[model samples]
Target chain A: MKTEMAAIEIRNLTYKYQNAEAPVLQNLNLTIEKGEFALVSGPSGCGKTTLCRCLNGLIPHFYGGELEGEIFVDGLNVRETPPAKLASHVGLIFQNPENQLFSFNVERDVAFGLENLGVPPEEIRRRVDWSLELVGISDLKDRAPWELSGGQQQKAAIACVLAMQPSIIVFDEPTSFLDPLTARGIFDVIAKLRRKLDLTVVVVEHRLEALAAHASRLILMDHGKIILNGEPRKILAEAAERLSLKVGIPSVILLHRRLSKLGILEGLTPLTTSEMAAQLRGVLNRD
Target chain B: MIRLEDVGYVYPGGVEALRGVSLTIGERSSLAIMGRSGAGKTTLIKHLNGLLKPTSGRVTVDGVDTRKATVAKLSRKVGIVFQNPDHQLFAETVEDEVAFPLKNFGFPQDEIKARTEWVLELFNLTRYRKHSPLTLSGGEKKRVAMASIVSWKPKYLVLDEPTLGQDRENKLRLRELFEEFMEEGRTIIMVTHDVEFAAECGFDVALLVDGKVSALGSAREILSNVELLKKASLAAPQMAELFLELEGVEAQPVFTVEEAERLILSRLMSGSGRP
Candidate 1:
């Protein structure tokens, strides 16, 4: 298999917030390929969001953490790069849309990042239109962020980040506040963008079922360390029990495992609801 | 009991949150309110406890109209737990946080202490009774918020997005607590988007869409209807959806996992295998 080039490279990265007892991230090493859709999931406060901030140059540059080792995003060392400079190559979307959106209107919100980058008015308008269209929130251009739904506001935040024309985008639990249908819709948009734009996407989310089918790879974090990194199916199947113990398992996977334990489900490990249904039907038919 | 007759709420900023909607929730029955954002689930919930008054129409709780009742009076019977724990928690310690509501209700110090101790023990937070609320974890904060409300022993409990930040273990524990509350005949009206949790809790389902009650029925009836769920911007629980797809089983939607298992088992035993 051909190896895709790395868009993000972390070498023995470690970081500790000032006045903390221990480091949040310790000796973490990872390499994310360009245009790959990766899901970073773990228990809350396990340093997943901290990792994201580190990737977008918010750690040493903006947060003033005790940083060690190196993080290079698109060949630029994050330690040396300022957040404003890194904003052009890697866009960061926070978990709370309210924190990211400060503009009076949706269009202005999307254009905020571009304006900071000193993009011309014509190009900024073009980029804002393109980004809004990508997130399916073009019609909400004139509305206040507070007036929009939680899902719409989140999409607008993503569009705001996308307007900067970043090659990589990192989302911190973008759907934590949304309903399941809306969450799925947001994931669909993310998948579409990943396919159409060749953008590297790293999302830290707990809704594994929504993203499991679309993510190119799944990275499981625990105690601020990446424990399992591989294709979704392989990682889920191999680390079933440990995964359940570390972080909550999705309902379908839990059901599949229970059935398997009872000798009612056999063949082909199922990681999703559809796959589980198919395998379950086959078992009943054989009986 | 809580009743809404042609209720509507237009925010001061001119946003129509809840349209003219009518519904009644009987005492001791749990109801799950499901909807997408901007569907007015929150707005409808707020009306139950008199947090927000209807712009048109009436909202009554326990024979008292919300518009005519003080928030304090309604709060004694109706307790609401917001999504963010920080919003409700203001006390320096967990014990005080749980007792704050009781003190506001004018309970004696001895009675408040007793209730606080009971709730702290009930939620297994006794070890952290003296700990600062700000130092607690997200799940801990949630427990404190729940403990505060449950300590009051309100007749009706309304929880908004109870499982938003909870882990699987915590979620399961919450289900157990809700079941206990139901067994004791306390009314629980939860506003949530978690289909699996909703299904497992065995509550009657209410689908709120565009500030209206789009669909209202038993969990089995509402969740099995895929078309209605789609229109409400909701998804059927994975197990419920899977059971519906089975050949011999005529998609009788069930809320709880145990119910789904029992239905599937009965169909299989009757020689009606997968269709």
Candidate 2:
């Protein structure tokens, strides 16, 4: 029965920050099955960060907000659990890598979470090495936080979350500060890790092109409500029609949309450059 | 025009961020600096405003040597918007924030008020004029940071990663704003990792690799070169990649969706449409 439970379950969730005029998230309900990778995105101030806080027990516990609803993570009710305990089940990586990583070296930063959970020294050491190798940052284990580049620092941050061995991971625009190549590298690491570990991952990002290729589901939020949730391709095609949504449609899909309107590649939307390229070759080769 | 004569920069702790980089930026021109995270893009822009003096060479903005000029003086001609809005936004109200720079520049009270209102409307920040800048969202705060610097209307506007947190609407607005600036004969220098946005802006590009200018040219020439882009740890725009993947497509420099569409339509017309 426990194995059949969903990785995350939310029901009738409404939350408001302290001294706010109205609720930030209003009657939102979502369920993410085990091993499902969800990409949550919207304009800034769309309550994506607030939703992330609710998952790791930060809303009712740390933020001291009015949380009226239910959230279950790894079969544990988030509101009933303390953040310190929830840290073991759900890991939340912030947008800024500098905010979470404070230890002198990468190895120490990775070990901090396990140490706080009262894991023994040997276990911490083993977990740190395993997570560092998982992210391919083992060579920078001895380097200080400031000594690493932005991409390297973000990798270290992800390694810190991985060392906790959580069942679910939530990233809040982790690649917002990264460049195209570096951001792609971070996304590739995430995709590889999810495959290798079968981890349930939820990411909040505006750069849809980088993450859409790997996401099993796409969740679009607006004005604190889950406006659209479904397959990435269908949702993106729908989003393309509604200009008011202001979601950044990947360029390939935009090109696909343009070609489809011209009676070419109708009813087909490609997400990646390669996918669009293959389709373009078919159109070009046709005589 | 701004000129860098063999400029080099090294931080206090012995981090060699920039090496012998010599380039000349013509007046009324736009240049987008693209590179990896630690490739010294920020360090290179800082030299323009006298924030970081060159260690080995010289930087001159309109014939004024940066080393001899104070930041305050250089700022009058070069207004820089930092990457993180929180670093520069410390005002009680968005209106006051935009006016602060004008006041510092010794604009008359009437002119300051007019300019503040003008820029507030320009950024669509009039609705939040009375609100504290700290209370705004990340995107609004970035706009306020931009409004503050732009209020002064410096001859050279420097933006560090202007598209970091912006949405689609804001990016479109930015394109219009850059066009308006260019029409006024003002130069815009932006440091960014957004290759697509840079391509849309049609900016001249300088690719940095390990604090050295590895490649410099028009956006089409620099961004369309896959091998050169890889050297800077970057990739070509999606459209360019798409056309490149289609063998013998002959769309050598398509960077945006519109450009790609036009190219594809032409190709299809020549190919006599799909079967």
Q: Which candidate has the top score in DockQ?
A: 2
Error of 2 at B265 (Å): 2.0
For model 2, what fraction of the real interface contacts is kept? 0.64
B162 in model 2: Cα distance from truth in Å? 1.0
CA-RMSD of model 2: 2.7
Best by lDDT: 2
B1-275: candidate 1 lDDT, tens digit per residue: 89999999998879999889899999889999988877988788889878899999999998899999998889899999976677788998888899888988989989998999988876668877877775554556778998999887888989988876565666776787787777788899999888877877778998998899989988878877888888777888877767666642466665554565666567567766655
Q: Model 2 chain A, poorest ten-residue lDDT window?
A: A1-10
Q: Give the Cα lDDT of each candidate.
A: 0.81, 0.85
Name the lDDT value of residue B170 in candidate 2. 77
Docking class of 1: acceptable
Worst 10 residues of 1 chain A by lDDT: A1-10
